[model samples]
Target chain A: MEAKLKYYLQIADNALILSHRLSEYCSKGPFLEEDLANTNVALDLIGLAESMYIEVARQENEGRTGDDIVYRRKETDFLNVILVEMPNDDFAHIMVRQFFTDVFHQQFFSELRNSKDEFLMGIAHKSIKEVLYHLKRSSEWMFRLGKGTVEAQEKAQVAINKYWKYTHEFFLENDTDSEMLKAGIGVDLSLIKKNWLAKVEEIFTMSNLTIPTNDFTIEGGKQGYHSENLGYILTEMQFLPSKYPDAIW
Target chain B: MNITALSKEELLVEFEAKINAEQKIEPLDWMPDEYRNHLIRQISQHAHSEIIGMQPEGNWITRAPSLRSKKILLAKIQDEAGHGLYLYSAAETLGVTREQYIQWLHEGKAKYSSVFNSPALNWADMGAIGWLVDGAAITNQVSLQKTSYGPYARAMVRICKEESFHQRQGYEIMWKMMEGTKDQQEMAQDALNRWWWPSLMMFGPHDSDSPRTGNAMRWKIKRETNDYLREKFINKTIPQAELIGLKIPDNNLVLLEDGTYKSGDINWDDFWKNVNGNGPCNEQRLAHHIKAHTEGAWVRESAFVSGFQK
Candidate 1:
């Protein structure tokens, strides 16, 4: 049960953190239509987080609500990957971050639909459809910006170089992952990584972009270590709930 | 359809007759330059207001008290962006490009609602903005659905539907907070205190001082006077405030025997000051907008160069 809870938290925290990052673009998109698109994507991610958190709460059976699990957790308790917590420095960086995750989720959720856990299967089934649309949108932007103009191409390359190292953390297996895999209630990370790399390579080729050749990688988010940005995100996200701990918002 | 053959006097008589009969004015229809200019200014300002309005409410999206509240706030702000697009499209029919309108906004040549110049300091301000600010906008927009221009009226029809949802969500936030702890109730009241008069100012200056009201009313462009709509909003809103156990923030607020609610005079000096670009957040709002626009320049250039113009 603890392993399953950790697995669920790992996925939920990723969605929640990334949704928080994207929500920052709510009223600040490059244009009106793009703003709406970014919000739609953010809403989808947050919705997924809500569902996963609900499942985690039910599984824990400690009378904890989804909000309790999400809003009351300390920074060291979160299990999101370091990639999702990275700052959205520009449109290029935002789209690259999303593009990397969407590709991974496309493979991860598709395999997750076959999980032995019924609840996990149900979430994966619903999430797969949303992630496919997300994949299409992010990939289209990646192609446009990568192949468009000299400046856009340069910006896209810079973002890819900065974010590529974080992609390695997606495949880093831990005890919770191994336990879920043994129980047939989680995806095989190695397989998902292989498929993710293949799809990313294909898209990069089409976009006239190249993958980073550096072997260095950043890790630790799944084990609760995170960048400084995650602390700021938590401070803001948990401010109201922390201040009035017992009040219903 | 070539009204070029008709003299200006003859065209003016026909145009006046169409407007008198409450006929819809299409983009291709023959109209005076003044009418086109009036609609452009009004419609573009409306669009810019939608864009700028996103900022105040957006200040709370990251810190909303709950997951549900966060989602609601995000969707509402997205709707504002949609409203901005719709109004910009409506303005484009008047032969001005969206680029020109955006440029004008960045240059401070175009004006949006001054109500947005105020900061949203507390979570309750979200409720107040949605309730009072959006409430006032709906009163004006409901009248705009009957505006003389066809495209503008259609856009308002779509906008008012979404805005009604925004107003309800805002009110729901206020209601929830009022029913919560004492601190929550105080926050709700404080939000009202800050947002109240600025909301009244959203109706623009009094009719006696408004120069364009005469031409706008004549052309059926403005369906109601600023003072008239402001009065209607107060009468409708005062009851809701009382029901929620919140004060109206005006000492002079009173109910007359005629069923109208009267309030004290608005701070015209402040209103004019904000309108003239001296408001508290005027520079901040414009600066943020310009920064976003400038940063996104590369993305826009890429999209255009990639043949994704549409």
Candidate 2:
């Protein structure tokens, strides 16, 4: 695939998969209003994904459509960082995961607003508008969970520990992203990652939560390797599209 | 001695002219203590209702039929929580803290809307909640926007603007299911039947039986009576039910001479029973809430420790 086409697909696939993960909280959130807010974020993510996929299809010349890109793609073809695809083991875990990803994506997309690529920049621009709210809401929860009580403090710390390993992969720059950044396609993930870490570290310190230092790190999400969670997510997400190849609903 | 006493009649020439003229009553404005208490009770209950209302619909997040549906539902639920927060803030303007209100709920002194106590059985229940429950709520909310309390009225105005989409999404679910297979249609109908009465009961007891109505109406807190909105709901919902190819659960639902659909007597006995904690899912619902509160204690503590830095 051409780099631009591949570039668009990476962004699109990440949003699509993560949105699927977020949407899982539809009826299962601790409260009704939180469910609604979370779901709105999910919709925004998916809508953003569709737009990116359309741009990707335009460049591919493979006769593929948005649906084809989203539903037809197998697990190895997906490119979302593993941080988003992780399970919502508990409400704290979910909030921490969302906080980590949203803060990172906010920086990434905010920089992409100035991209030389018109369509990619446009999508990123619109997406950052929606993402600001997610960042605000998720950041608030992280603060609350981290600072509220002893138990809440411990839970936040544990969530930070468990998910910290996956956070590194978000900034891992390969040829595709680096070349695009040079052409002003988007920001370099490595730079965005550095800023994301600094911001998150400040939050962690203030929240009275400790960041775990482990030499072991999970990689290869961008390179098509993912955790076991993505497979189940893919199974449920692809079921309808797989059954009816051209289904539009 | 039979009517007016001599001393009282001699002194009765002077009343507060502005209060008698129906001028806006500020918190510092002198009034009966009963009026303040009544406003507190009503507004606090309204605030509590918004908070607890999140349960039934929240139950369906894991099983939303589609990504679109899930997204819509989530947004709607978030609005409900925001509404609760807004109402709490409004109530605080009347001199109450949110912590006190939550404590009342924990101690079983505060009451939320009775409708939310029921379970959301399936995806269709999500449709029913949005369509009927939120439909009834909007009817009341639109009226409440004109309520006498300044802050409460403003909150209602904000809530009503965002509420328009909620009912439509719900009815859209029913529309899809009605056009879907037999099983789906039946699921929608079953949800409608089970939820119909509970939803109507949400407006509270009949006008004749409700003591708070006269005072609330006089104070402009409750813009309309229970019977009034219930009639409007029937008149509006009956046509909607026809469009969806479903029957209204009540058999005696018929158009009156004024073109209002007269519904049957609401079973207040069942209402009281449910209010007394014997509803089908009341225990289960509270249990879930308490568990979440307990389990998520650590997160709240951490948030405090973080000191709002993030």
Candidate that would win on lDDT: 1
User: What would the per-residue lDDT of candidate 2 be over residues B82-147, giving only the tens digit for each residue?
Assistant: 887788787776677876776677667877777888878866888888899989989888988877
* DockQ metric for all predictions: 0.71, 0.36
Reference-based TM-score of each model: 0.97, 0.81
Give the distance in Å from residue B185's predicted Cα in candidate 1 to where it truly belongs.
1.2
Query: What's model 2's lDDT at B107?
Result: 68
**lDDT of each structure?**
0.92, 0.76
Interface CA RMSD of each prediction in angstroms: 1.6, 4.7
Candidate 2 residue-wise lDDT, A1-249, digit = tens: 777777787787777777777766554555435656777788788778777777777777689876667667889988888888888788888889888888888998988888898887788878899989998898777667766766666776788899888888878887888788788776878779778878788877766677787856887878888889888987776664465443233
* lDDT measured at residue A132 in model 2 versus the true structure, 0 to 100: 90
Give the DockQ of candidate 2. 0.36
